[model samples]
Target: MRRDIGGVVRNSLLAGAALLAGCAGTVNAPYPPIRADLSPAALARGATIFHASCEACHRGGDAETVSGAPLRELPSYMGRFHASNLTSHPTAGIGSATDAELARAIRYAVSRDGRLMVMPSYGMGDADLAAVLGFMRSGHPLFAPDSRPAPRSEFSFIGGMGFRVITGNEPVERPASGIPVPPKAATREYGRYMAHDVYDCASCHTDGYSPRKTEGDDVFAGGMAFVDPEGRKVHSSNITFHETGLAHWTLEDFTRAVRDGIAPDGSVLRSPMPRFRGLDAVEAQALYDYLRSVPARDNEVKGARPRLTATSVRPAWVAATGAETTVQGTTVGAPPEGSATAPGHGPQQNNVASTTSQGPAGGTATAARPPSPGNASDGDGVTAPASPAAAQGSSVNTAAAPARKPRPAAPKVDAPKLFVQLGCASCHGPGARYQDRLAGVANRSEAELVRWVRNPEQFLPGTPMPTYAELIDEPTARALVRWVKAGGPASLSSTSR
Candidate 1:
């Protein structure tokens, strides 16, 4: 009887083991299918959605960014992360994945292998999700065929646990069917969809992910800064239709700025401000309408640094001479030896950058105050004039001096600082180990440099470099071009390597 009992127990254990093995084999099988519409209209809609949402990261052209995981292995975070090429190429792409598998990946961030994916769920509408699937099946492939499996993530055990805890495997519920996006008319409603859902403009423009917060009305207030490859700091402009925001920008101005990269004043926009290839005039108009409709905030944004001019020298002179006097309309003292200025060209009247409230007419223009003698003596750099005697007998070259011919205004921009601020040095300067140093760029002509910055794609089609046609004014762009032509950050060093 005891021998019979042992045999039964052994058989039970073997049967349990076999069941577990069978369950393990199903881990990579396609998940249950979700209803997906694959009509031509859906595919077309998907193409536009992909361009606005996924192409920026997954298009396998420009260097991959961290925000959108590249569909192919590319440089990121001192290493590399990759997303599968969602194309019809066998072995190298997701052509082999079943509709069920693709749907699961999009809906729940669950891969075919049952591992959690890092792709963010953008709360896609049901039609949008279906459209994306259709697009993957029929759209043109971006990368060449390769059979290697997408690399496994190097996430730590703790990280895996945290991700599982926070983002559970529950699939996102699809919106009710047939609720497609409204017509692409230049209406405020469509504009809202394009801005908040498709382009994610608020993601970059606002201070952090405030859109997801309860106090999310701060969207488009614009406090974000993008450090360019050169180390230039590019602050996002406030798009709110307020005095401190886009109060001066008309719909046409916004359209031109986004599409042509030409600002209202005809300045060049800095890099990382990519031109949306497929964002058409209609879409741009719609976006503009939506921006106008949003709540206006009075957040003042610091845009590109003011371009260097003759007037830019006043603050430095005041600090250096340390003595103030009313020497007529001239700079109180000679610039310290080896300064960039010529003999008599003193700080002009409008040397101090200031903004005055002229109601809606001025539109919050940036204006500078001319450094005055009384204000100079008061140390605030602005005040009513003091007696001429107070100005004449000052320590910086006292007594009546000969009226020297005005020297040419010194270049006020520090090339190194400008190089970093313009983000040129970050990608092309001394520290850019992965890229070629810009020492040779100093050889390009000013016109060529300006042209390149204004529109690099015109010269090199499909190039990853961005255009600065709207982010920088002519003078600032000229200064930067001159610096690049003069060997950039390395020019400051005594020795060249």
Candidate 2:
């Protein structure tokens, strides 16, 4: 009886493993071609929805700036479960996506075969889903034509090992289905769907699993980190409603920072957060709205580093100098006595190597020397002219002659009007006492204003101020800095008048 029972359990385990393998392999099925011709208005609405929802992870405008995977290039980038391009291209674009397929992908997170999909089922309302389909069929160029392989299973090894251990049987082999479906959509009730579903903003901006539970109100408090190619860590700020978030920022200030990479304090933000140089006025506004609506939390993150000083030089610089000494071994002459290293340039040289290496006046060696006049012969025996005019022309041609397309002018954004549209005044203006306090802070400098805008928790940790890290990019941050330094509405109006 005991042996019989053990055999039965083994068989049951094998059956379960087989079932899981089947589920994993057949997740993605071919989508049916879109049949209905969507109207222009529908397409326009879809575009707006896409900007608010999908753009964050996909394209984020034509700047090619990407925080998540690019949906436009999905057909080419995603390995197995490739997202079809939504452009009018003949072969791979979503011009062929059926309304049914679009609906299935959005609301149910299922493919045409009733299989689960890998997409996040976050913010897709019925209207927004329909709008996204319309935009997909709107005949716009979403991506270039390219074939993409399906994504490989990340859990295959675990499944195989588990099958071996439990059932004493080989794991079933099958093609992996990359489709993923959530039990329910988080943003479906709201009209905004694309940002939540396709872009999957909550995956990073909010803590995993129960984001609401972790962040009751603080939406973006800026503590996420990304490692660069050089292995330096870059963190994402928290965008929440606590005093540490972007509670003090204005809408225009938020827009400029995202589009331009300029901080609220007029400082440049580093790369990886690409500048949204290609976004038009309408797209920017929609994104702004979606971000404003995200629930704010109260997470107080550390402030940015204080200004760099001589003592604050990165360890990499020190290492490089030390390495040079060991390898070159003083072949590079030391600096002359009493000569100090220039501020921006590295250490000074002690002795001049050649007559042409004469030091500049004021005991500083001219770091870079002007090219020689007239023609000269090279060590390789090639004769070259040293005409400064020709050199200058070549430099200009190299530097300035790229055939770059002209960027469109940014639309003028009115902070006061936007504040009203987004109902910011409900908590910030006359009805609330918050306006009085903000008004009193008007005389602060741009830096001071930025400190308050970036995070209010430093001054008042318990106060309610949403961090705008997700919503407000660098440029928009700077604009808020300008506005705050100018004293919000009163200063703005005075300048306008």
Candidate 3:
């Protein structure tokens, strides 16, 4: 009837020490060392990875001048989880952490002092890992010393106990040797690598990120739960190409949704889903290929997305080619506000409303820079300045971000093209179930129509029609609205083609 109190305490201490040892084991050989890359090229690649993956949390729309702000302050059952300072500042940032310590923190999900920090387990290859770590230490101005004060992560007692039980099984093993990156292609193999390894999409998409998920099974079927910084719990979408998932989402649709955070049905993605507008066309298509290749299960994630705080105002972060990022002070370039697509550029993909496309060009559709979201844009993602001036044309006052050149502009979105580009025709087009969707458009006032184009959610709270805020400016929306009001061009097929 008596408890072995001393023995229990001794055993608890031993267990804790063992777990801490496992957490710190990632710094040794076989796991790529932090000393591998500090060259400009390596740092650049690291910057790209950070922008595409880490920026959603770390950058959180903060301009470069703002001392690294406490990005997210999540209140979960696990306790207060604050996004830590990643800058080079000695105390308030990672400057005090050794390279090995940072690597352990990032890949092993263990802090320097060896406590659990609920970060996604990274499976980055040797080269990629080296680059990212190198960038963190490369003295880049964006990551320059920022002594921003931020709250430290503190886990609840229950949460800490749960983490010990759940993650106590040593983390997934790092590669014994460098895991080379797959070739960049739309092939299922590369796509699979990109989805799971590069983007770590599976980390959130897989329900609870269950460790024993079967590849090509329901792992990518979604339902992984997340609590936004505001404490709103939302389930990740079932992205497999199943009936309840993307269904017939074209590659283009997938791209638009991910890059711009707009859904095909016009619903905007919520916080925690960074519009990876930074992904280039090929990279995006690779993800699409991977998703389509996976097994699809029916798991509908139904709920209103929690509103965002630090997203939407995305300043550039090691820019790739999403519509919202900037390079140095330049916008990567868009047309003047409310202006037509610039002369050399085709049509601005940013537009009034709709979803994505993976048309006849195969999954190789030209990458479209998203139109910067207007301040009034809806949803849980973006709140870019309304003016094209902030992010259009040859000059912009963007944050200090460096990058490879922007991708070529998307093809024009004239009335006929626009009609199909936004997936608008899919519902109202000839074969759709609702050709009458625009039946009364001719009677609506131009202002009302413009509003509809810019923000369909205002009219229909859960409409699948997304806003053109990140794709087109007001004028283009007005033009499209006028075109829709006029019954669309007679020559155009009601079909999206």
Candidate 4:
């Protein structure tokens, strides 16, 4: 090969310049100039909003990955990924971010370098965004004093590289400032604000979120799937006023379901369902009103109950930790030894389980809040605290140690008759089959079935299926599981009314 010395030198210099440009690209630019209110009332409102919206994910929400770590260390995808800290700590949190920078992060998910952070762009009015910034500015760091880089896998950096290349790290365009907010009323306009900005109901209930998602799609026709800690699938119910949705539900029914986690059908919502007990009365009413106002889409989603029972399989990330730190899912760390649940915190709060589907025991459910609107640090996609009743269900097993020998098996029972009588067919309905829906049940021993039927929530912390202990005798429940595994002898005549 002939050496072109001058050409090589010229190319080297160009390469160096390119490298410098790349490095500079990662440096976040100063935020655009903007003024914001920092009044105490605004700050207090921000705090309340934080607790209602941001606290689930950032405040030690992921018990496995972010546990024992500072709140600044936000967890995403369980503990595998995380968002930048929002606390007012110069080193670890968004303390250095300018007010405009913070706004951009929330409204656009862009970093100082104009890099896209995995955040949702909330279509919030300016006042609401300003309040969030004010709250963040006044807030002190609650967890870590020093900042920590988010945990990463080998491909994480590569993924980031791809994102920057694709997005070009363009800063998010700011929305109009000083826009008027809807008055806190039960009117549809205010209800829209509460639903989209305050409680973020549409983000959870609908499909994918984008700048244009709200304008185009049928909002609140729920189809999101939330997996419980025990690996059961509970699809977000259709809240639209369609027959397959919440057409029959009253406003009172909606309130009880959101505030209490109890469905009108008498079933308890599974874990990861944050029963917003602290939701303001007005806000709750507004949300209900907004849901009713939206056009109903008849999306017939099923598996609104515990269907999957996974076998013991640990996650790959868990191998590094050794011990199987199961919380909601394959958690990487344990909660601080005396880490008590925050007062008024739901059962789903601080259950640091990982959401990854892989690892030693297939990735189990982990708790993390979804991103909040106009609040970059807030929101874990699966935000919802378990209800008080669901929380109590978790401790039932801890009180007693199990006997080594399994209990006596139940006698063979008729499943077809039992299924009809107990209304199992009601939710499972006509077309549903045990072969596809029922998981991990056929293999469970009679003793196991006895424990499960008696109190599924006790064994599986967030299962939505009500306990059958009261409905059926232990022997019958055991026999029922056995018969279900064998394939119910009688097929349903029609869908349960």
Candidate 5:
């Protein structure tokens, strides 16, 4: 009888082990169909969403960030975190992942191997879901197949307990049907979708743990707490229509703030606040409309740095420099393969590498690029000059610029603009590894900061930063550093900068 009982117990244990194995992968399976599209407009929308949401963590390095390249660390996560390669490479990326798998991962924050992740976005509407995925799979140069290798995330003891044990297997209801999004337009409906569903705007703007909200009394009113990649606690400012928020802000002010990282009060926005230079005018206006339409909240966020104080304002010394003052700009993180605008490709030495209709001060600027040998630009250092008729329709087919007439090279810009337009922000921008270095710019004396800015190689040898001593004068560098020292960089693009 004792032997019989032992056999039964052994059988029960084996059965339990088999059951656990089966349950793991099926936890978030049977992902519904999204019916994504590969249209140019869809690709553009995907690029926009990717820029606003995914670029911060999934970046490969300081160079033009290729999507799907793995990053090894996150801010204070106490884990060997590696942002998974999101590219479509057959082995190195998510190329093998089925559409349903992608859907489940996005919806449930579950990894392909069944590990729960802490993704900022989950369960977007169907239209947007289709567009974003379509763009990723459309073989665009940014998301095209790449075989770069990086390690996967390895959680520590505490992290394992927090994510896997406590929050990992929570029983949240999955959507039985597809979520719906608004029509593409400059309307509040689409704007709401952008803020909540696609890329969460309040992720940093909220102080609470549950920052993601679809509809709330206080969405963009601020008080969001963020720990930068360097493990610093950064305060998020209120951005509502209240006097304490954006009550005094105009559309142009809001546009410049997002595109250039400058504030209405003249203070520069700090790092971790994404600078989205490629954000189109329609998207900007739509987002602004939604923010204005939200209920006014009186929360005055504190501990936020670079508040544009009277002391931190542009010093009078700028006038003595006898050079022009400048402001900010940038493009999305991902650049197409062989892109002329990619870092090391464009005329960055001139301090004016790119031009966009989206200007630093919320104006339009036609790019004057060097002429390519052929009639069109084939990912070369050229933009085919459009005729009057072609320029109007450029909005529809904006992603691809093929063979066209060549334009002249752009004239040189000032040193301050060079800092952003030349891609300096990628290494020092929001959540960048070296972002901590910018704080010293505010603390050090004028001459010290100026010296470092003029020739960063002098302060730190073997640095990758380009030397600007020849381009900028002592007074100019001094004034420029003082002017921008209040805030850290967000991001600058090769195309938009």
Candidate 6:
């Protein structure tokens, strides 16, 4: 017999309630101490880390994936635990969280009560964690106003379910080493490092960027999507060499877009692409250097459209009715000429025997007929050749769906070529004021660098940084992480193993 996995799990949990009786003991652990005066640099780093890592599941109040829940406006029904709103709301937010508590949550995924938190713990380092804490302490509110019901004890079930789904009994862990620091110098190697690892420029922009299929071209031509809590969908845009891409965008334009979510047109990019607003001058310049060196692809993609209604509510019978409607020459009202018995024929001769009987009035039935040799119209008005071979072939063709065409390749660009086409050197030049700042940070670990690159807001709460998460993906983030952790050098390629 087939077993229902979810039902079985639910039943087992209910049966083992005694084992989980005291799981809620740590629900009211004391908040950590707060440091109100965090430096700009530290806040900037924190912001980046938050975007690259935290925002994947917490942006715009909703987690990007289904299992993840909304962070903002969390219903009290979810009190088993919620990703506390990171904004500076003192009464119910992370504004009062101590740096140590923040660090524990980030790197260790552990709450003050020593219980595991269900946050993703990838690419975090000591300095980076501290920077995030400093940034959070810097007093910036990212959420809009919304009141939810007060949390309750029963909500712990939600936390338990989340733990089962997201944590899977895993213990909290941290990065093995201290955060690496970058040097003060302008090097091609460093530029590549910042682009590939720190900022994760290649993640969502490249097609087939997985470790197994990393050879495809089309760098920076975006096509990524995220689902919101209410089931809305958002897509990443193309940033390539094509005219419709970011071809005309200046480095400043790109920078502003990444850090602020403000497009060149002055529009706010929607959720999941968190506003950076936290990057410092040095980190921004480093990102600029890397973007300049990337090869450009010309792939153009359509912007996002509204999501479809929930599948559950859609009419199930509509599909069957539609399929029947599309069969050529078939009609419910008409019957075929030869199949209809003459008026004088008896009831037995008049009724074409159906293989499956239909219920009286509301009954259902299946109708089958012996093979015919000549082209003929069925009583249902569907014109089919009576020949068995032809009918079989037609049925097969209808059943075997047509194949789809392969998607076109994305554009590609070499490092130096991209620098020239995009005019990156205008702000990131050697000896330039901005260049000196980026040079100082060429050696930060990939995780730290990516934090800065994706969004700077987590660190510098009110600073001006742009979000690059739209232009990158997880794989590219990993690649950049390797490059940054290895000292932000081109020769230090780190695409997994």
Kindly report which residue stretches of model 6 are placed more than 4 angstroms away from their true locations once superposed: 1-69, 72-82, 85-101, 108-125, 135-176, 184-223, 228-231, 238-248, 265-267, 280-282, 291-497
- TM-score of each candidate? 0.50, 0.39, 0.58, 0.49, 0.57, 0.38
At residue 205, give the lDDT of candidate 6. 52
- Candidate 1, residues 367-460: lDDT per residue as tens digits? 3333443433222221446567666765565458887433222223344654553345545655463235355565677667666765665564
lDDT, model 3: 0.58
Off by over 4 Å in 5: 1-26, 63-74, 164-168, 171-177, 211-218, 229-231, 265-268, 305-497
Winning model by lDDT:
3
Query: lDDT tens digits, residues 1-497, model 3?
Result: 13688888889878766654543343322233555388888876787777667755665332452133343433366666656678778887887777777766666666665555667667677677778888777777656777776577655655555555666545556654457877767678877776777678887777753344535467877777777544567777777777667766767667867765665444456556764534678888778887877777777767632222222222222122233422112222333334444222334433221123333223222334444433532221223466666446547645777763422232234556656655566556765544665788788897787667755534532233454554454444555677777777445665443
TM-score top scorer: 3
True-structure RMSD, every candidate: 15.3, 22.3, 16.7, 19.4, 16.3, 28.0
Worst 10 residues of 3 by lDDT: 310-319
lDDT of 5: 0.56
True lDDT of residue 62, candidate 6: 23
Model 4 Cα lDDT, one tens digit per residue, 181-226: 7887878888888777766777667754343445556678776655
Sliding window of 10 residues with minimal summed lDDT for model 1 = 325-334
Using TM-score as the measure, name the better of candidate 4 and candidate 6. 4
> Which TM-score value belongs to model 3?
0.58
lDDT of 6 at 259: 68
Go through the candidates in order and give the clash count of each: 31, 67, 23, 27, 11, 38
Q: For model 6, what is the error of residue 316's alpha carbon versus the real structure, in angstroms, after optimal superposition?
A: 51
